[model samples]
Target chain A: MKRLTGFWAFTLLLVLLPIVFPDNYYVTVVGGTALMNAILAVGLNLLMGYAGQISLGHAAFFGIGAYASAILTTRYGWNPWPAMSAGLALTGVLAFLVARPILRLKGHYLAMATLGLGIIVHIILVQTEGLTGGPDGLSDIPGLAIFGWAVDSDLRWYIVMAVTLLLVLWLALNIIASRSGRALRALHGSEIAAEMMGIDTTATKTGVFVIAALSASLAGSLFAHQQSFISPDSFSFFFSIELVTMVVLGGMASTFGAIFGAVVLTFLPELLVVFEDYEVMIFGAILMLMMIFLPQGLFVSGQQLLRRLLARRATGTAKEGSHGAA
Target chain B: MNIRKTLSALAMGTLLGLGALHQALAAEPIKIGSFLAVTGPASFLGDPELKTLQMYVDEINGKGGVDGRQIELVHYDTGGSPKKAVNFVKRLIQKDKVDVIVGGSTSGSTLAVMPLVAKARIPFISLAGSVKIVVPPQKWTFKMPHTDAMAAAKIFGDMKKRGITKVALISGSGGFGKSGRAQSLKLAPQYGIEIVADESYGKKDTDMTAQLAKIRDSGAQAILNFGFGTGPAIVTKNVRQLGIDLPLYQSHGVASKKFIELAGDAAEGVRLPAAALLVADQLPDSDPQKPVLLAYKNKFEAKYGPVSTFGGHAYDGLFIALEAIDRANSTDKEKVRDEIEKTKGFIGTGGIYNMSPQDHLGLDLSAFKMLEIRNGDWTIVE
Candidate 1:
């Protein structure tokens, strides 16, 4: 019940943000981008933090979703909603097909395999000029519409993205609190032990992987519709690395932490834009400082500090009461 | 309690900072908003472009600004992502509320923000190269660089004059390369030139010997390389090492001296269509572009170390906008858009910009000077 209230508060904050900013660029434009990255980070956290599988090619799934929707709607003249759904389905299937062999790999081996997949996908997107429009990428993609109303403006996208992010967080929280979520935690703790304990490690791992890929696909579809344009450059090995950085920086296992991290990473560069040539330098320095100060991740350390403080206060009062009775 | 305070304080600080950043200037100057890839994969193009914009803004402002209103430039580094470019465009339009927008360093970035400017009805002067940015006439967008088709036409026209009927085509896997290759292939037959061999290399590929070896054996009379960045230099070096004596024709992308330095001894006699600013030292004073090119070259190199034709694109964008501002005699966006479209015989860094209702880029074939490298420098071919 408390968690539900917190979720509502987060949603309420998101809902009221635009009202406070009132048609400002930060709320409408940068806020939309932050929400999209948050969705991707939250999905990635499930696999990396919960299932304990590393994927260096999340951007490939993102690219798949983007390109799939872009091609389907623009080329075949399908409606935006159906095209996005088709993209999501195709991404889920692709994830399943690759997860079995890939999940068997462990540690750096898995990371390398995923990285290779990302590169191969990016290369294919670049080489397939007739379909992907070569490196320039496809344009003139139509925006998403609900019923007869078009979601064209940035302010509208901000509202849509905020609602979607909160919903994804709620789903993640429920999954984490469920029986399967316990199984995921057990496997994350010790996969061999989980297998010995009659847990279907392969099935659970593959399920989470597909779920993560689906989330990424949905985010990508929304991204394609929102921007109405995409290119191979947007989904590169570097972007995958960025996704991983967001997850780790925000506290990989924490859902809200993922959101926090995404918000920070997305806004940091936008904030640094005023710095001109010093932007990259300052951004790198700030990130380095954050990592050094909070080695366990930003949100994780903050929560740990709060817990320690509360525990110390509780124990102090209890000791005082015993001493007074004595 | 302490952490919560800190978090709130940080948030407050950021909001305050942004507020201060967006505070309107006291003098009521005309704002020129720009977004470029100042840091990223395309920084090679954007860095010089940024330098040019900054230099010109300062110079114009020093002269009491255009129309007696100090030019206040609100520029952002897009980092070469269309997404980032779009965000910056919104910030510039909504928050800064600039009078006109003057930058887009890549074709993709420009295209991404095209709908925004069109909807906002703001006069946008694009520095990126892409025919789609202006085609179908988006009502308020203008470009400075020659379109890919124009550059290809220039190259093929030269090929026709030299009686070269068969040529080998090599391009990179980039937007510029892909567009250039398509234009050349589409127009080759009309120029009576046949592309006997076609090859492509990745952007990161350091070697092109394999591709050149195939071209050497393809019975081609010449090689036409269509690409920007380090790929062209690699092709040039590969051709020289293979001892292929056929004439090598390069796209306008390699007009900068960086290409010559990268290709070293192999750069000599490589012909490419380039803006007159590149060979400004060699052009006669009678040339329309000579004086403007020399002035920009002198001022820009003095301040920014070195100059390139890519930076000249930004120069053209600003001055053309300035010309419109001067003609309109007001900061109204619609008037500026109309006046910019009325621009003709305006000689700036890129070329003589002649904007029309049908054509956004006003340059003709004369804008590009056929230049060949000699003694590690750009020299006019004639």
Candidate 2:
């Protein structure tokens, strides 16, 4: 009930934002990008925060998703829907194949393995000029359209992205509250304890890993269609690091936390444009201050503050009522 | 009756004056949007370009503005990321409602935003190096720099004259290098030159002795580098260190004083094709590009240190856009785009542009002056 309430509130904000500020740059243009980042971060949080795994190369899956859709649609003349499906299947299978071996590695080894995977994918995108169009990238990619409506304008794209983000969030929330969610929590606590509790640790890790990669793939496909262009530059090692930052900064194990972090990171640099030459420096300092002040995470600490205020008000009213009765 | 008549006349005159003032206020400044990779791996290309645009936009405004309307520059630092470029471009088109756009600092960023700019129907003058931006010309897009293909042709033309039949290729793995290599390969056979060996180094790689050694063994008479920044400088130094005396040719990517400064003494006798901006002082007064080149060079160096052709590209793009806006006599998007397409004999820092419906770039091989580094300064080579 508590989680659902917060989730609905987040959805409400997404819904009401465009109405309140029609065609707002931050809410619509940058907001669509924020939603994409939030999707990737949410699934990643499920893996890293709950299953206690790290993927330093998450952007590779993202690139795979983006490139797969891009090449299939642009070269093979496939419909966007089918092309997106192929990307999902390809990423899912690849994730499953790599998961067994990669999941066997513990701690930093796992991180290294994922990082290697990411670099290899990026190199392939650049080196495979014939298919990927080299460093120049493929342009004039067809945008997504329904039978009647086209997802062409920023507002249309924003609505589509917001709905997709909501679906991902809902699915994530359900997963967190289910039996597997408990198993994930158990995994986070201790692998040995999780295994002792009759959880299939190998299968669990693989499932979560595959799920995380699929979300990135989904977002990647949408990103390609929205931009109508795909480039290897968009999916680099730094992007992977940025995803991890969103998850950690938002609060691990908190879905809404991931969204909060994604939005902040997306909006910060755009809003900091006023700083001109000092923009990057100030952005880093502000993020540093946030982490310092809100050690628990942005959403986690905010919730805590809200609860504290509510409890104080309740007690204060009760004390006044007692005085009146006496 | 005389007092009433005087009061009515005065009231009518005041209303007419207020209406004239309102009309004057309605003539808004021309907003020019720019996005550059001013603080990233491509900063060397974008920093000077941004400085050039800023210095000139302010100057143009101070000169009573273009067509009596002030030029408002809305610039963003993309950090060489295409994702940021796309968003900032959207902000430029939809939010800022810019009349025209004048910057894209890298091939990737330009290509990423090209389709969007086309859809927006705003005039976008690209400062990037890719020929794809203008080739088979999109209706509203124009470019400033000599395309990599043009550079290859100019170099190969010189190669053909020297009767150099075989050459080795060493390019950077970045966008510029890759595109240049492709163009060279595509045009090599036509120029009657055979590529004896081909090698590439990573963008961040500082050592190229190994690549040069392989080129030395290849029976090639000369070697050409199609990369920019420190990579080209490093290659030049490595070629000298290896004692391979074959003539070294570089692309216009290194048409800057910084390249010579970086390569130091090893840069001596190295030749490349560049804009007249590099050899501005050496050009004859009769040269069509002499005045524009010298003016841009003098003003840019006076304010922002040394000038590079990359900044010259921006200078050309801005003035060209302003020229179109002036010719059209309005900031109407379609009219300005048409006027820009019809640009002829426009003196710019890059070259004398002759834009047509067929050729959006408006530069020929004559615009590219082959230059050699002599005494750590650029000198025109015959």
Candidate 3:
């Protein structure tokens, strides 16, 4: 009941913030991009934070989803929503198939394999110009529709993205509290221990991997529709790095942490306009400082402070009660 | 607790202060936003553009700026990624409230920003040369460099004039290379020539001997290699190593001296069509592009040391944009866009640009001069 109230409160705030925005530009530029980053980060958190699997090439799946929907809708004259569904299904199936051999590798080996996968995807996108529009990228992607109403405005798109994000978050939180979630945590702690406990480690890992890919695909689809265009360069190696940064900067194991991290990282560069030349340098420095000072993450730091304050309040209340009794 | 309060206060204060500064800055300057690939693989293109833009801005400001308002260039590094490019352009339009935007070093980055600029009704001038930059024609978008198709047509036409009937082709499998190949093939028959041999290699592949050997064994009189950057250099080096001494016709992309440096002695006699900036010494004094070329060459070499045709495009792009702003007499984006579209015989470093609504690409084949590397120096081949 408490979690449900909190979730409603959060959703209400997100939905109402755009109403107070001074201009449509603000909602579209800052709010829209934040929502997009949130989708990517939350999806990635499932793999890195929950499944204990790191994929540096998750953007490849995102790119595949974008290109799939784009090509299908634009070339074959299919509806955008159905094409998006097909894209998500295709990415999920692909992830499920590749997860077995890929998830077997651990640590740096896994990182390199994922990196190679992203590079190969990028190369193929660039090489196959006839279908994918080559380096110039595909333009004129159709907007999202429900029933008969088309979502064209930034506010409308933000609502779509935020609702999608909330749905995914709800699903993810549920999974985290479920039996499979416990198995994933065990596998993350120790594969040998998880196996000894009779947990199907491989199946769990593959299941979570497909889920993460689906989330990325869905986000990519949303991104494509919002931007009204798609390009291979949109899903480059750097985007993968940014997504990873969001997962880490947000407390790795916390859902709220993902949202906080996505918002900060998305808005930080825009707010620091005067220091534009040193933007990347400052971003790197902040990441380093956070890693050193608050190793757990910004979310964990905030949580620790909140806990300490609450503890002090309880202690003061107990002291007052004891004094009155005496 | 006091320290925590103080830190939070400091953070809030800094944020407010920065926001206030941006607001103040916004009111005073004619904000021009630029999206450049400033810190990635394509930084090779963006770094020069940034330097050129800085130089132009400084020069304009020294002359009291346009209409007595200082020019402020707000640049964002897209890192050569289209998604970053789109995000940067959106921020530029919505957040920075820029009057005009310019500089997309790569074709992918340029095309990504086209729709946003159009939707926002802001003027955009692209420095990249992909034909698609102007295709389907967004009202606000314009390209400074000649397209790949035009470059191919000029080169192939010249080859036909020189009686080079059977030409061997070598290209990379990348977008730029593939586009060049397509244009060359499409335009080949028009020039009454045939592709005697065609071979391709991956962009990152270091070995080109097998591809070059195939081209060498085809018994072609000349080889037309359509590639840029390191790929062309490798092809040149490999072709020399294979002892194939036929006339080597390179695409305009390899006009840079870096190609000669990379190809070493093997770069001699490589022919390509380039702007007058590459071989400024050979251009006649009466030529209309001479003064513009001289000024750009002098300023660019002083600022960046040795100007290439790429930088020449940057110089021309900046000059054309400034000229349009001056002609418009106001910072109104729509007016400036219209002024730019109606540009006729606007003397620039590359050539006289005559832009039209149907033609967003200002320059054409006539803007380029055929040049070859002779004794490690760019010289007119004719």
Candidate 4:
């Protein structure tokens, strides 16, 4: 119930942000992009944080989803909604096909395999010029429409993206609180022990992997529709690394942490744009500082700080509440 | 602490003076917003482009500003991502309320922001090279750079004059290289040149000897490399390494002296079509572009090291916008855009820009000078 309230508050904050500042570019445009990234991050966190399987090629699924939408709507003249669904389905199947073998490899070997997948997918996007428009990438992808209303403006896109992000967040919370969620935690704790405990570790790992890929795929479709432009550069090995970074930086095992990390990583660069050439350098420095200061991840540390303050202010009343929640 | 104190004092004095001037003049500075890949893979283009804008904006403001309004350069380092470009361009339009946009370091970025700039009805001057930025020209977007297609035409035209019909085509898979290759392949037949050998290298490939060997055996009369960055330089070196005696042609993507430096002795006799700025020192005094080229060359090299044609594009873009604003006598978006489209016979860095309703980028093949490397320096060839 406490976690539900926190989730509700987060959802409310996202909903009210653009309404409060409709004209603010950061809130509308950057906020929309951040929400899309949050969905990707939260999904990846499910696999990496919960299932204990790392993916270095999460962006490949994203690329598949984006390229699927871009090619279908633009080339075949398919409707945006169906095209996005096609993208999601393609990514899901591809993830399922590759998950069993790739996830079996542990540590750096798994990383290398996934990295190769990302590089191969990127190469395909570039090499298949006739289909994907090569390095310059496809353009003129149609925006999504609900009935008669078009999701054209940044504000509209922001609203759509926020709703999707909150939906994904809600799903993630429920999954984490479910019985299978306990199985995932058990798998993360010890895969061998999880198998001994009669948990289908392989099936659970594959399921989470596919789910993460689906989330990234969905984000990709949203991006393709919203921006109406995507190049191979957007989905690269670097981006997959960034997704992993978001997961780790936000407290890998925590869903809210992933959201916080994604928003911060997205907003940080946009905010630092005013600094010009020093922006990249300052971004690196700030990330280094954050990781050093709060090794437990930004969101987890922030929540702990808040709870500490609450405990201090209303120690007797909140003591039982905190005990029951954890 | 002492230096910090002095710096803060200087900042304070400038703020006070600006405040006083704001009340006295009451003329709002015209915001010339820019988004460049100043610190990314395309930094070679964006770094120089940004430096040029900053130096010239400061220079223009130093001269009592344009139209009695200080030129305020609102710049952002896009890092060459179209997604980021979209965000920064929005900030430029919504928050900065920029009068005009004067930068986009890559074609993809320019294209991504074109719809936004069009919707906002703000005149945008792109420094990227790709004809698509202007082809089927958007209402309020203008670009300053010879298209890859024009470069292909220039090379093929040069090949025709030399009676070379069969040519080998090698290119990189990057945006510039891919576009240049496409243009060459598309335009080769028009120039009565047959691409006997077609090959390409990846962006990260350091060697091109294998591709060159195939081209050599393909009975090609000459080789034309459509690429930029270190790839072309390596190709130039590789051709020499393999001792292939065929005439080698490079694209304008490698017009800078850095290519010659990277390719070393192998760059000799290599030819490419480039803006007049590369051979500014050798241009006859009577050339209309000579004075402008030399002035930008001297000014830029004096502050920032060696000058690249990429910087020249930004120079033309900024001056064209500023001149149009002055010609219109207002910073009004529609008027400035109209004036920009009306730009004629303006001799700036990237050749003489003459924008029209149909031609957003008003340069032709004549603007691209065919130049060869001599003694590791750029020298005009006919």
Ranked by lDDT from best down, the candidates are 2, 4, 1, 3
Candidate 1 iRMSD, 1 decimal: 1.4
* Chain B TM-score of every predicted model: 0.91, 0.90, 0.90, 0.92
TM, chain A, every candidate: 0.94, 0.95, 0.93, 0.95
lDDT of 4 by residue, A145-233 (tens): 99989888988998898888888889998999999899999999998999999999889989899999999999999898887888888
TM-score of each: 0.94, 0.93, 0.93, 0.94
Give the best candidate by lDDT: 2
CA shift of A135, model 2, Å: 1.1
Tens-digit lDDT track for model 4 on B263-284? 9999999999988888888899
lDDT for residue B314 in candidate 1, whole number 0-100? 90
Q: Per-residue lDDT of A1-326 in model 3, one digit per residue for the tens?
A: 65466568778888788877746665656777888788878878888887778989988988988888888888888898889999999998899889999989999999998888888888888878888888778888887898887887667888888899899888887787789988988988999999999999999998988888998899888887777777777888878888888888978877778877888888877666558779889877888998788877788677876766776788875542222100
Could you give the CAPRI-style class of model 4?
Answer: medium
Q: On a 0 to 1 TM-score scale, where does candidate 3 land against the true structure?
A: 0.93
lDDT of 3 by residue, B269-357 (tens): 88888777777767889888888888888888887787766666677677677778889988888899998898999877667798999
Query: Which pairs of residues collide in model 1?
Result: none
Q: How far off is residue B369 in model 1, in Å?
A: 1.0
lDDT of 1 by residue, A1-20 (tens): 96577688888889888998
Give per-residue lDDT, candidate 1, residue B116: 84
